[model samples]
Target: MSDFLQTRVGAALKDAALAAVITLLLASIMVGLRTKTEQGGLVIVGQWGLVAWMVGVVFVGRLAMSLLIWRGNNPVANAMNAMLPKQDTVSKIGKLVGPLLLLFAVTLPFYGNRYVIDMGILVLTYIMLGWGLNIVVGLAGLLDLGYVAFYAVGAYSYALFAQYFDLSFWVCLPLAGILAAFWGMILGFPVLRLRGDYLAIVTLAFGEIIRVVLLNWYEFTGGPDGISRIPRPSFFGLEFTRKNGFADFFGLDYSSMHRIIFLFYLILILALITNFVTMRLRKLPIGRAWEALREDEIACRSLGINTTNTKLTAFALGAMFGGFAGAFFATRQGFISPESFTFMESAIILAIVVLGGLGSQLGVVIASLVMIGGFEVFRDLEDLRMLVFGLLMVGIMIWKPRGIVSSRAPSVFLKEKKSVSGDLVAEGEG
Candidate 1:
């Protein structure tokens, strides 16, 4: 017992020291840079006191966590385990909760403040992006870091057509998706022979290529200035104008919110379509081929699957959904810019898929809410927001390394259904 106590104390001190070092590395720059001063000629001013305070906090907190929460008989772990629902209960809760959440979403505009409604639209946008990327990265086991290229394609497709052709948003929407899918196929065919890091690098290059082209092609893409005044989407034959429009047709007072509400539902329907198509496809032969291709390409070839076609289809479908979301974004914002489609956007979408637990639709939804919505909640915190975000992510990784929902339900189960451990699946091989 004496030896065990010594070990725990030693472990606590070790963790505290490690935390202090990391805190110094991360917080030193942040705290040191917090001072604001007007200067034509700059002076290097740093807040050493703030840095010291941050390091002290980290050391104490880490030591306490290591000793009381991480070591043997951890109360935090015990409490969490106790609070967690049984495996069987999860499905029951989902069944009961899914519809409730949907109903809340559908009715949110009526009851929610404008700010809340706006946040809802933003969250749903990322959710759509996450679901789209889930197809390529999660279902098909492709490592695509340039998914946002297709998003830009879709946006540009809509913006260009609407600009030159005097086309309605409805007309441009499908065309955008088709164009993006074509680009997806183009990118897909060339990268079919590559896998793992090579595939990721190729995709990343493709994204940069698209962005650079847009940046240089000033006449065609408006260069860095971006396309503006892109028409907002309207209800069929009914604009949401203040007079003689949707509000007038319905005999309701014209509020700016009508347009916002319409965009919300439009994206919602599109997201649902993406979800429905993905779910239905999962039951199809092509979807099974994707799962097989993900697990082991060699085994997949041995089983006579056309790996090339499978990969292309996954890319095409994923790009199609991304295009749809991009078009919606263009319509909602009434603008399209090369700046809007960056590598960071792709990173966030991919992170959503990985953090959500690959190929789990519900997990993607939950992860989107937590990541995107949670980030929005921290907007007031400014620089501190990122610090909190990093810590929260670290905590989650420590607690559930596989993700929030790590256990996957088998695509085809025998008489007894069982949850497959995430460890059993290869990366992106959901």
Candidate 2:
């Protein structure tokens, strides 16, 4: 028995040593790849290279320890194995409902105050935009740098319709979505085969094309001055304006603040609907196909997934959401401008998705809040605000390289657990 134990220990040590050596080698390679010589003769490190090296080292170290424990017949391996989360942690409905309810609970009271309501509306707008972008970036795994084009399409669709036909906000909303979706399909068809950085560049160019068209199409889009005095949303037969608002119609005191609050909640509901629909779609077969496609497009094609339809659907869906947000924005602001749907807007929305963490709804929400909220807060700072914002983003990236809300791996077969009802351990275990 003693000799057997010694042999097992010796084997474990050998395995551990091999793993450690391999880990170091990989780390060295990463460092070599990431290291850059500056013009000033200073050594600079690439972010990706540094992240890979650190992660590789940690992974290797963990593997070596595991190997050592296994070879030594150490009972601690059982505990370590148990510490790992189950693969099916997403099956519980409570996991989905709890966080959502919490969000609503925390945000509901702000509806009473005009400033708070406006902020809420802005947050919801970004949330809708982020979710829309998520369909392209998260579900479809298409990197779109020109997502603002769809937004521009939607906004302009509303503005044009309202300006030409005297259409109401409600009437233009669906039309805007339809138009945006149509344009998304148009954009998607041309770049169906493109992926990664190439796709991003093409999308960026497409966005520029759309913006240039808006700029040149002066008679229709109102040129750089944009369309103004676009109507706000009305309830039943009552407009939200001070004279004909619901309060006045109902013989109650009237305030423009009330109208703003109403609009806020309206957009909030719309955003919630958008989020709900997206989450439900994710659980459907199409959603599964999207995940598969995201993981490996080639494998998805091999599995008989219709990549073309998948790509088109993603674009259309994403554009539809953008259209919704755009229409709401036009109504809320009482104006529409090309400046509202620029490349910078696209970059900001994309940044929200990337910074929030790809494929994470909650992450997008938090990221939007941070990015947009920060922007609102920094409005007073003027020129220096942008610099500070960029620094904040850099800091966040350095601290949490994956994102603010990092992408979570999907559960295979496990039931979902609510964070509120169960302890984190229990949630993972179940």
CA lDDT of each prediction against the hidden true structure: 0.87, 0.77
- Show pairs that collide, candidate 2: 88-414, 90-416, 91-415, 91-416, 92-415, 92-416
Q: List the residue pairs that clash in candidate 1.
A: none
Q: Candidate 2's residue-wise lDDT over 205-249, tens digit each?
A: 999999888888898888888899887788876876667668888
| TM-score of each model, paired residue for residue | 0.88, 0.72
Clash numbers, per candidate: 0, 6
Weakest ten-residue segment in model 2 by summed lDDT: 421-430
How many clashes in candidate 1? Answer: 0
Which candidate has the top score in lDDT? 1
